[model samples]
Target: MSVERDILAKNDREANANRREFSRLGIFALNLVSSPGSGKTTLLVETIGRLGGELPITVIEGDQQTSNDAERIRATGAKAVQVNTGKGCHLDAHMVGHALERLAPAADSVVMIENVGNLVCPSAFDLGEAHKVVVLSVTEGEDKPLKYPDMFAAADLMILNKCDLLPHLAFDAALVEANARRVNPAIEILRLSATTGEGMDAWLAWIRGGAVEARRRRAAAAPRAQGCACAEAAAKA
Candidate 1:
């Protein structure tokens, strides 16, 4: 228990540093979490294709092996850094901070961190993202949220991907939403198919809204930051 607590404490400190750095740079970061085969990469590819022109976007791909996802992200001409976790099941805050240095995302831009495909470990590790967006495909059982309650409870929003497949599957979207709500009543839900482009506008709009707010926050903090710097300079004199 002590070891686990120590591990998380270190991660939290790193995460806070990352959050401050992101705010200072006016970067809106989103941590995308989900089980394997949740279509997270596909959604991200489509998202970048449509919204990258309007917003400066960079990607940090987290996986156990292979830079395949990062390659797909770069194919869209957006900057991407691949963090291969090797034996690790998740991307820790320290790893993401290093990746951010390499990504060098611009001010008022979005940094999409595609976490290693796992619901359990990623939920506990904070990557200093503005929000955690959990992706669940309709092909998965609705009881998923109930089984993986920690992930749903931790997420700010739950995205139901592969909605276009509803016609062919026995999956119950309503049940999944209900289960997710049971875990997190305040969690926002969005259903979309990355392949068919259905419901993407709403998702894109959400990203735009978040980016705007992130920019607003950075602008609001600038005066205080400058004042602190000036105070330090004066003290040195």
Candidate 2:
């Protein structure tokens, strides 16, 4: 118990530092979490294609072994750095901080972090992101949220991906939303299919809204130069 607590304590400190850096740079970061085969990478590729022209976006891809997802992200011409967490099941805050340094995303840009395909460990690790967006495919069971309550409870938004396949599956969308809400009453939900582009506008809007607010907050929090020339200029006028 002591060891576990210490581990999380260290992670929390690092997460705080990462958060400060994100704020300073005006970066809106999203930690995407889900089980394997949840179509996170596909969604990202589609999203980048749609918004890359309008928004400056970078990616930090997390996986246990391969750089496959990172390659896909790079194909879209967006900057991406792959973090292969060999034996680790999740990307810790320290790892993400270093990745941020390597990526060096432009100020007032969006940083998409595709976390290791796991629902359990990633929920407990804070990667200094603005929000944790959990992706759940309709192929998965409707009770997934109930089973993985921790992930749902930790996420700020739950994206129901692969919605275009709803007619072919036995999945109950309402039940899944109910389960997710049971775990997190305040969790916002969006349904979309990365493959078909269905319901993607809402997801894109959500990202845009967050980026705007993050940039606004960063500007508001920025320190003004001491004895600034702007005040002096105003006084002269």
Candidate 3:
């Protein structure tokens, strides 16, 4: 117990540092987590397609092996860095920090970190994201949130993916949302089909809002040195 606590404590410290760096760079970082085959990669691809040109987007793909995900992200014309975790089940703050160094995302850019597919392990690790978005596919059933309460609880947003297949599947989307809210009442939910582009507008808008807020916070945090642009702007406001 003591060893586990110590390890998590160290991770928390590193996560705080990563958070500070993200704030300084005005990056809206998102950690996307889910079980394997939950369509996280597909969702990311669709998201990038919709917003890649509008926003300077970068991705850090985490997987046990292979850089396939990163390659796919790069094909979208966005910069991506792959962090092969090998035997590790999740990407910790230290690993994400290293990936950030390699990514070098532009200021005010949005960085999406696609975590290794695992509902259990990834929820326990903080990768210094502005929010943790969990993708749950309808094919996985409506009881997933109850089965993996920790993951749902840790997420700021729950994305019900593959909704276009709901007609073929018996999955109840409402039940899934209820279960997610049971674990995390404050969690915002979005239903979307990455394949058909349905419901993507809301998702893109949410990301835009977060990115705007990140830049706003960064500007507000800038030092008020005499004649500094930020300070001058603030004084004018």
Candidate 4:
């Protein structure tokens, strides 16, 4: 058991190192995870439309088959790479590491990784993202967090999409937020209707916030990881 735990811890540590390297390369990356039809692609397209030219943005779209999502992202004026995971259920850090070579975003670019639409598997894998944004829709029911706690717990940001049609559905928005909070106390929630553009600005602001924060953290940790033990400790601290 101790050996297994050590292996798992080593994987997570390596994933964290990859994330630091991505930051050091001047890339602001985000992993977008969600179930099918949860509007992850729509939100990403909208994000690209708003963020394009201002920042060089790229996307990696993962699916079991077809490059459909990557096609949509390409239409939004962002470079996109399609990764058909075959039998794999998640996009691990190693996968992202390979995809980054194909993506090749500019020095000050943002990379959005749209993971395969699985609430369970994707959350279990670390894709070396600065933040994991879980896209949950009102149509998916409010008990989703209870059904798939790992995804909610792993997410740094939660996007509740499709709020425009709330009156026609039986979905409980308050219950969803409550349950998500129970699983992830520190999650930043953004309720938005991607179709109607209702809450998009807030979500965009949160994305900007994550990018800025990631860059600042990377800059602050650069010089300390040189030689001394105290310096290494200070770099991480």
Tens digit per residue, CA lDDT, model 1, 10-112: 8999999999888988888999999999999999999999999999899999999999999999999999999999999999999999998998889999999
Q: Tens digits of per-residue lDDT for model 4 on 23-63?
A: 77667888999998899899888888876756677999999
Report the lDDT tens digits of candidate 3 across residue range 67-180: 999999989888999999999999999999899889998999999999999999999998889999999999997999999999999999999999999999989899999999
Mark the 10 consecutive residues where model 1 has the least summed lDDT: 1-10
Worst 10 residues of 2 by lDDT: 221-230
TM-score order, best first, reads: 1, 2, 3, 4
List the candidate 4 regions with Cα displacement exceeding 4 Å: 1-14, 218-237
Show pairs that collide, candidate 2: none
Q: How far does residue 96 in candidate 4 sit from its true spot (Å)?
A: 0.8
TM-score of predicted structure 1: 0.94
Each candidate: RMSD to true structure? 2.2, 3.5, 4.1, 4.9
Model 3 worst lDDT run, 10 consecutive residues: 1-10
TM-score of 4: 0.87
- Give candidate 3's whole-model lDDT: 0.93
Candidate numbers, best lDDT first, in rank order: 1, 2, 3, 4
